[model samples]
Target chain A: MEQALYQAAILTFEELGFIFPIERPSDDECENEESTRVSVKFNGSVSGEIVLQVENTILPTIASNMLGTEEPLEDEEILQDVLGELANVICGNTLPSIAGKNEVFRLEPPRKINKLEAGEKPAAIAHLDVEESRADVLLYLN
Target chain B: MKISSRSDDILITYALGSCLGITIFDPIAKVGGLLHVMLPASIVNPAKAANNPYMFVDTGVPELFKACYKAGAKKERLVLKVAGGASLQNNEDSDQFQIGKRNFLMLRKLLWKNNVLIKAHDVGENFSRTMLLEMSTGNVILKINNETTIL
Candidate 1:
């Protein structure tokens, strides 16, 4: 499940934002103090949440890459929108593999998470190192 | 994870969706600690929990408080403030597993068992929140949608 989800996330991110993710060991010091986390919920044969955390410094690069612009965008809304869409796509693509191709799933819109407090351990956690910046993809099954 | 100086050191945690962010501070010692917890219990995945205890409230909360204590913050003089625990969009059905709500409940249960009370908090909404803890003054700040509020 973790491998499939990681593959789905990598493919979606590359195709949409032209960003690539590389695997790395988890290190608390490497986490950004100011990061953006987006969550999307899916329900069907299986129910769960997909969480994506991207550092603030990498937002402009992600937005510009997705928009095909050379200029770095400082707009928070656009940056969040791109991140949300990336999470949505990853969630949408990863569900079928988990729930079977014939099963249909409903996905809610990706929303920003200001903070994360507690719950189950992420079923799969992928560390993506992109352009000297890092992002995380976490899947939680409920 | 901890700031021990008496200066303007700040510890921040970002985008807590269903997860929770907790801040512990000692005014006398001028020390503070911040923890971001992702789940309610560590029993679900003991292996992962063993590695990343911060991913669960049950394990993370205790560890966070311990860190503060190790930093010279007395438990009796500690101020606790919390934020986060947000439900996902379009979750109108009550039967659906509400991870956010459950997370908050778990937090409350743990605090109660430990005889710790929250000094201030902003939680249980549909929006994400960022939390900041300043060691100098023991002030906890909550940010959401570009707006800031003292927690």
Candidate 2:
């Protein structure tokens, strides 16, 4: 499950956002950076959610790159929207690798989470670093 | 937040933004409580939370349940409902202060840790809300804009 999340994040970020995620990233790399969290819920053969937490520092680059713009976007919502789409795509890719392509699933629109308190354990987690920023993909199964 | 044993008492909370409005009711006891919490954790400012526990989710939730228990509400029979976590992200000057989302997350984390499940919720959006609880029937009501409905 962690591998699936990592793979999805790698593919989505590289292809769509033009950023490469570092494997086996240093845990302390992003300790002091702000993080933006987004998640997409899916229901069908299984019900659960996939979460993406990215360092806020690299969001502008990711958003602008995904939109084919060289300059950073002027709107914050656009960056949030891109993160939402990133979660959606990563979720779309993740379910298939785990559940097989035969299974059908319905995914809800992505939503941003403001803050996450102490640990609420997930089924699996993939932690990576990108552009000196950190990205974590958490999978929750219900 | 208020707890009522009176059959005709109405507990209502208004203009809930990123703040969380939690309602707990016990049908058998005819007791109900409404809680409105502004911040996620009391640790942000211990002085404020110590003075008014209702200002934060961590402190307010425990207080809400304790009060309900004192008012004769059994934890096992309590029906919990939540509302109000908004972003205010509409139009040009959108405000992305995600206090509402933070409050909702903190509430969920706290509830999950205590083995509590929310029966219903009308949460997360770009609009403000007003929540009401009827002590008579334990019906939770949500009023947004000109609309009113059961939550």
Candidate 3:
């Protein structure tokens, strides 16, 4: 089941115009079950976080992509939209695989979070980071 | 002249690929309106006119204008700004999802008929965007990820 989830992340990236690799979260970031965090690192400073929950994943990729520019990035609003879309796309791709076909899942529009508060309880959290030259995708299932 | 208000402000959100968000503000009347329209025109989904009025340009634009007018806005004083209509993932695998380009074209036609002009806009890209229009001051904010820009 975990491998399937990882494969889905990779497939989503390929479908979403990002190039990267997948890996496990470091020991320091491990948490309880029902929460997952996936991290993927890509070239050009394009890194993103995917926080999974029963309702939705706080996909922070849209913000990352906007900020992941070769030029010095300085916009906050665009960053938020980018992260929201990233989370939306990652969650949209992963939800169907976890839940069976019959299960109906509706994703709310992605919202921006200034910080990932400590000790915040979520069903799952996933973090993904994609780079231009290489990419890293990490899933931290709670 | 039409102006629309949603409680304290009007919240219009657009999603999916290659779709745009158009917001009109009439400062004189202190009225603001937003539309999270998907396609450029009704041709994309002519059959679902009554169901998803907000999803098409033809019906949605008129409705948005009417809503504004009802709230006490005039056509001459309206200010317009647009966002969205992005294509972060360009895939030719299907034609059903070419909503971004069609949406832009439809908006152009509708505005032309009404003699409405767009002042500022952010459109066409592979990235998705979410926009907010504040009615109090007619402030338009665009969000992408960690960055926020007032346009």
Candidate 4:
């Protein structure tokens, strides 16, 4: 599961968002930055969800690169939407590996959530680093 | 199903997931409504449909049109727009759990039977949305994660 999340996040952030992964930052490197989180739930042969949390510092760059525009959108809502899409795509890519290619699953739209609201402990987690930013993906299954 | 002739009337629905948010308006009549349908077919739960006809695509879509027409809307002038019907990644066409796609297909099928056509739509994606219908302007507005657009 961790490998799946890692691969999905790498592929999604690099290929889709055009953001490159970088060396993992030490725990103290990003201690002062704020993080934004999004969650997507899926129901099928096995019900579960993927929660993705990314540092706020790199949001503008991600949005700007994904849209390929001259200027990055500074709107908080637009940034959140971009983050939500990232989480949704990551969940969609990772689920097929764990649930099998033929299994049926319905994924709910991604929504912004806080760490406290993620509820149960995650079954697996992947922490990824990209260009001075950090992202964490958590998988919860029922 | 809610309809209004007054220009100030605005019908809004929020947080659409696998469910659908359907909007229709008639500029001449100034009547419009928004329906949030959860399922594609009423056959899945006839009892629930009987009680809340606006919960399924098959039963609810007809009622929205009927109410609009009764309130001075014409079939020819009614402009329709739909949003929400998102699916998970790599979802096959045969996946029964793809309620978003099924709901959209059922809606199109029902409307096609009536010879009605959709003007515009933002459907089929892995995202949630909030829809608003302004009765005065007959404009269907969609808000996805706070980014707003007209359909």
> Which structure among the candidates has the greatest TM-score?
2
> What DockQ does candidate 1 have relative to the true complex?
0.01
* Model 1 CA lDDT for position B70: 78
Query: What is the CAPRI rating of model 1's predicted complex?
Result: incorrect
- Per-candidate TM-score against the hidden true structure: 0.50, 0.57, 0.46, 0.50
Q: lDDT tens digits, residues A1-142, model 2?
A: 7788888988888667756566654243322338888889999898899888888788887787677564767587898899999999999999988998899999999998875435666787777877677788888898
Q: lDDT per residue, candidate 3, A1-142, as tens digits?
A: 3444556655554344223333445232533342222322211111223443211122234233233332323354554444445446665555555555555554556553333446644334333334312222233333
Q: Which of the numbered candidates is closest to the native, going by highest DockQ?
A: 2
Those runs of model 3 whose alpha carbons end farther than 4 Å from true positions after fitting are A1-142, B1-16, B90-97
Model 1, position A139, has a per-residue lDDT of: 88
Pick by DockQ: 1 or 2, better one: 2
Best by lDDT: 2
lDDT of 4 by residue, A1-142 (tens): 7778778888788655655554353232322238888889999999988888888888887887666554766888988899999988998899889989998889999988865342467787777776677877788898
**Model 1 stretches with alpha carbons more than 4 Å out:** A1-142, B1-6
DockQ of 2: 0.04
Better lDDT candidate (1, 4): 4
Give candidate 1's iRMS in Å, 1 decimal.
19.7
Runs with alpha carbons beyond 4 Å of true place in candidate 4: A1-142, B88-96
Q: Per-residue lDDT for B56-144 in model 3, tens only?
A: 77788888888888888888999999887766665533444546655765576457546676898888776778788877778888887
User: Residues B38-83, candidate 4, lDDT per residue (tens digit)?
Assistant: 9888987889999999999989999998898888988898889999
